[model samples]
Target chain A: MQAKQIDYAKEKRKSTLGWAVAILLACFWLVLTLTPFVFMVLNSFRKQFDMLQQGVFHMPDPWYFNNYVEVVTHGFFGYFFRSVLVVAVSLVLMLIIASFAAYPLARMKFRFCGLIYAGIVAMMSVPMHVTLIPIFKLTTDMGIYDSLKSLVGPYVAFALPMSVFILTAFMKTIPKEIEESAEIDGCGRFRNFFMIILPLSKSGLSTLAIYNGVAMWNEFAFANTFLQTPSHKTLPLALNQFKGEHALDIPIILSVLTLSVLPMIILFVIFQDKLVKGMMAGAVKG
Target chain B: MASKTENKSSLAKVRGKRVAVAATVFLLPTFLLIAVYFIYPVIDTFVISTYKWNGISATRTFIGLQNWVNLVKDKNFWDAFKHNVVIMVFSILLQIPIGMLLATFLDAGGRKFNIFKIIWFLPYLMSSVAIAFLFTYALATNGGIFSSLASLIQGKKVTVDLLGRSPHALFAVIGVMAWQYTPFYMVYFIAGYGNIDTTIYEAAIIDGATRGQYVRQIAIPLLGPIFKTACTMSLIGSLKYFDLIWNLTQGGPVNSTELMATYMYKLSFQQFNMGYGSCVAAGMFILITVIALLFQKAFVVKEDY
Candidate 1:
């Protein structure tokens, strides 16, 4: 009985130790993730002199809120709005086109369904830069170059393959009975897709939207190459100019970076579960 | 009854035509769009790589295999390829393992760990440019946090030129890339671990298996497919990596941080050497294809269950 009691105590101690170690490790990663953002936000409120005098870790003396005001007043908001518009338009179009394509491929029996799906999955493997030069030339040749509108077509096209593949994978899991019941009620193919499949695929569609939105919003290569004008620039390109434009105004630059990064962070917090689910579904299963 | 069968067969034929029509209507727009914009551009990249031409000016000189020949001999191209290989190595080494470890911890962490999962994933949500900028400031020579920390530790003022210096530039880029992407793998592996049957864990414990043995012997084996998938993703992404390097270093002070994508961009856009740029891109495409095909053949789990 005494030995049994000792063993029970030993087991409890081991588990407690394990718990403590896990918490410590978790906290370490938490600090690592949150520190940069905290540093960015905190340092954004400190002036260059203050930062230079008292290291980056120090709190701001007076907390200069004007840094943020300056960003908005100096046309950073235009870049912000431009990014929003571009991502919004691209997301909407990608959902529609990819869904339309995916519906037929997933639901209906077609001769080339396998071929088309394979082509899309293959397309996903081809990096954006491979086609960058050609698409740059193609857009320029067509005289649609150097405009925000120029970004829309390519963004949608690039977003399609993955979106379609994810949605198709999702739609495949959906029972055929749902569509069959709709068909029995005298609904045509297009009508059934519109009223039934489209509604049913909301989770999948939103998942694709989150994935594409995050990507297109952060997409620097195409935006940087295509939209050259300052007014036409997206948030990323504008942030890039922080190096040249602001020189070494560290706080101001941080403020601008904060501005650019804030929206996505907010969106992420709001749609955290959906974003996680979407990314997992899109990536792993794909 | 024979007449009724004939009528039903005609009706079925009409439904088949309608299905065909609907499929075409559904498939046509995305198909046409991808064909024109996506497909043609890839094919055109191959054709353009064969000639010597500026990005503009219709006067094109056909160099045949000359550009391709130059690519084989190009030092910068090879250097960039080497950098890509390094990135792939580090990503597999650092990113996947760390991600998997965190995922395992978070899986066992329970509801309290949910908040930590969200916090950890915050980096993956932000843009590469923003993340790069944040890190650049943190690592900058003057008044940057990294330098300040080093100065404090060494008892003297010191500045590390992370993005500017050649020796440190590539590693800095890799570090940042790993930092940004590790969370993704964490989330991915979490979903993977969640799929494993919990009864197996209970069984193992009942059989007197230690925690280490349970995770190592059983969990790791079960996660084989996910591990392969993550590795392939890391490999392909590393090979084609550009944006972070471009924004951070622009392949930097003597091309230390150059990768295939950045090199291709520099040649095409910066130097106006569209033909050579196309060649580099084609090389990247071929490399990526070969790697992807090899991974698919070798590591992809054969059984669905």
Candidate 2:
């Protein structure tokens, strides 16, 4: 009995030691993660030349707000609103088309069901760079180059494969009997989809919306390639524009970076659980 | 009886035709968009690779296989590809293990450690462009975070030239990539841990297993499929990495950090070498597809629940 007591004490000591190590490592990573953010935020409040004079960790001498004020007044919201507009249009179109394609693949009996589903799923691994040159040519040829309309097609198209794959999987879980009962009331496939399946897939649709929304909002390659005019650029390109305008003023550029990232952080904070759950939904393989 | 059977067969035919029509209408838009954006562009990239024309030119010469030959011999292209492989290997190595460790910590500590999860996930909320710009300033030589910390430690002002040097630039970029993406894998493993049945933990404990033993033996083993998926994702992500590197360095300082995507972007967009850039882009696509398929075949992760 005394030996057993000793073993228990030994195990408790070992577990406590393990916990201590884990906590220490966690705190170390926390510092590593927050230091850059602190640098960005802290330096953004300093005058342009003051960043060089003071230590990085030191507080801003006078806490200047003019950088932010300059950034906002210099068409920051134009870029912000354009991004919002493009993402909204592309998202709505992507969701509707993805759900439409997913419905038949999930519920209906079709001739090329397996082949079609496999083809769409395969496109997920095709890197966007492969299509960059051709899309650029196509955009210019169509006379929509450097316009917001050019972004819509590619955004909707690229998002379709993953969205369809996930939504199809989500729809498969929905019981078949719900659709059958609606069909028995003399409803056609179109009505059955609109009235029964579409409503039931709300949670799945919202998850896709969140997932694809984040992606389209932060998209850079296509935006950088297609949009050249400053007026047509999205939020992701705002940093470049600001940097170009103020080549040496680091504070103004940092303020622009902070502003661009602010909306996403705000959205994440308000929809924390939903956003996490949405990511989980996307993570599950079909 | 014969008349009734005839009538039912004709009705069934009509229903089948209607079903086909419904399916067609439903799938048409998706297929059309994909054809324009994905399928046609992929085919067009290969075709354009065969020609020698600037992107804006209205005419072109059929260069045939010359571009392909040049790409095969081009030292810069191969160097960029080698950089891509390095990033892929390191990303899989660093991000997965560290992320798993973080997730395991959270799983062990449970609800009280939710704050850690929140803080760890903040990096991922910032876009790649934002991260690149933030780190550009954070790692700068003068008054940067690293230099400041070093000066404090050594009791003297020290400048750290991370992004400007040759050998150090790629690794610095890799470290930044890890900083940006580790949170993703952490959350991924957290979800994986959440998927494990609680009964297994209870069973292990009943069998006199410690919490550490339970995680090491039962939980980690069960996360095999998830671990493979995470690795595959990191591999593909690293190969096609563009946005952060583009914004951060533009593959600069003697082409040390040049990746396939950045190289192709520079050729096609910056230099207007459309034909050669198309070849490079096509080459990258082929390599990624082949590697991903081979990895899938090799791993063959079975969901044996």
Candidate 3:
């Protein structure tokens, strides 16, 4: 009986240890994932003096809100809108171009579809550094080099390769019979493409659209290259300005970080399920 | 009426080729864009690699394989290449085990897994730029989170300026990368686990396979495709890695962290050595292409008709 009691106690201890282990792992992961954002948000609320004394953890005693106030009045809001416009225009153009390209590869029989797909995937592997000089040179030659139009053009081009593949893969799941029946009607090829193919491709288009949207929204390299003018700079590029060449302001810096992430967070919360699923799915293979 | 229609159909059949031609016309717009944007750029890059020119000065002299020769000799190119190799190895080593375990552990936890899944993936999606911003504080020397932890663990106030030093710089960079991408692999592992037919587990259990053995044999094999694909994708991503490292280190602390892509960028645009840069670009393109093809052949299986 004494032996039995010892075994029982040992089993209980084992189970308890298991729970502890699980909780510990969970806490470790939670701290890693959440703390940075929590730190950013907390630091954004603190005054500059308080920010330096603490490394973003000390609670602001007065709960200063001046960071947001400063960001708003500083005309960074205009910079934010510029980011929106660029991302939006780029997103729409990419979808249109990718779909236009993808529909043929998916539905219509093309001899070089594999080659085309390979070319696109191969391009993804090509370092952006490789194309930077030529693209810039090309942009300058095109006369809209520093303008938003020039920026949008290469974006649509770069985005086309992957986005088209994604759409084409998705298009494979679409019933070909619909296109056949549409073809039998008086509808011409162009009309069928626009009316039938485009209509049926909504989910695929949206998924690709969100990928481009977020990418363009956060795009740094090209914007840094093409849009050197303060008026032309997007949010990511503009955020770089908060810190001068050498000097740094911790509170304002934190505020910029907070502001950069806020739109994405809001977007995540709003379309949490769809956005996460779509983005992850897109990320995996695309 | 049917007979007359048939006669008319033969005449219309001649026009059917015209219709096919018109149908092909719909594809022209997109095809042209791809040719210009993707196909042309590659051709242009290859052509540019042969010519010696500083981007702006308007003189292009033909130089045969000189840039390629220079890249092979350049210590900077080698350093960048080695840096990427380190990233690739660490990517495989760090991501696979941690991701696999987290995925498996979270799987057994069931409903609890949902919250943790979201929590883990949240960091993966956090902007590379933003994470760089935050970790600057987290890993700093003066009572920084990492520094504080080091003090507590070692029972002495330890100091390491991770960013400033070469010893820890690459590790620190990979640590952030692991923090970000581990979730990416976990998602695949969890999904792969879920798809395993239930009877296989029962058979393994009846045969007296332990949990560890079962995971090693069954789960790993089944998750192989995902592992292979992720490995290749992440490797390619590692080879051309920019943004995160760029945002994090900027190939900094005396060029200790430069990858091939970042170096190529600096050479091409920053220094205006367009000739040598495109050669490096072509080199990268060839290397990536060869690897991708080898990967496709070796790992990613396609059903041959």
Task: Say which candidate scores most in DockQ.
Answer: 1
Superior candidate under DockQ, 1 versus 3: 1
Say which prediction, candidate 1 or candidate 3, comes out ahead on lDDT: 1
In model 3, the runs with Cα more than 4 Å from the true position are A1-23, A110-122, A275-286, B1-23, B105-112, B148-158, B189-220, B300-305
What's the true lDDT of residue A253 in model 2?
A: 91
Going through the candidates in order, their DockQ values are 0.51, 0.49, 0.30
lDDT (Cα, tens digit) per residue for candidate 2, span A1-286: 3333344455557689887888999999998888888899999999989998888789998999999999999999999999999999999999999999999999887688899999998888889999999999999999999999999999999999999998999999999998898888898888899998999999989878877898999999999999999999999999999999999899999999888888887887777666666656656562
- lDDT per residue (tens digit) for residues B33-123 in model 2: 8898899999999999999978888998898999999999999999999999999999999999999999998877776788898889889
lDDT of 3 by residue, B1-305 (tens): 12367778887666556554653565566667667666677788888999998888778999988888887898988888899889988998988778877878765565535777777767655566667766776677764566756766899768768888985888899998888788777776776666666567656756766555667898778766667667777888788777777767888878998888877778877888889888888888777777778877866454232
**Candidate 2 chain A least-lDDT 10 residues:** A1-10
**After superposing candidate 2, which stretches have Cα over 4 Å from the reference?**
A1-14, B1-14, B301-305
Clashing pairs in 3: none
Which candidate, 2 or 3, would have the higher lDDT against the true structure? 2
A252-280: candidate 3 lDDT, tens digit per residue: 76778888777776675565455545544
Q: What are the C-alpha RMSDs, in order, of all predicted structures?
A: 4.0, 4.1, 6.1
Backbone clash count for every predicted candidate, in the order shown? 0, 0, 0
Q: What would the C-alpha RMSD of candidate 2 be, to one decimal place?
A: 4.1
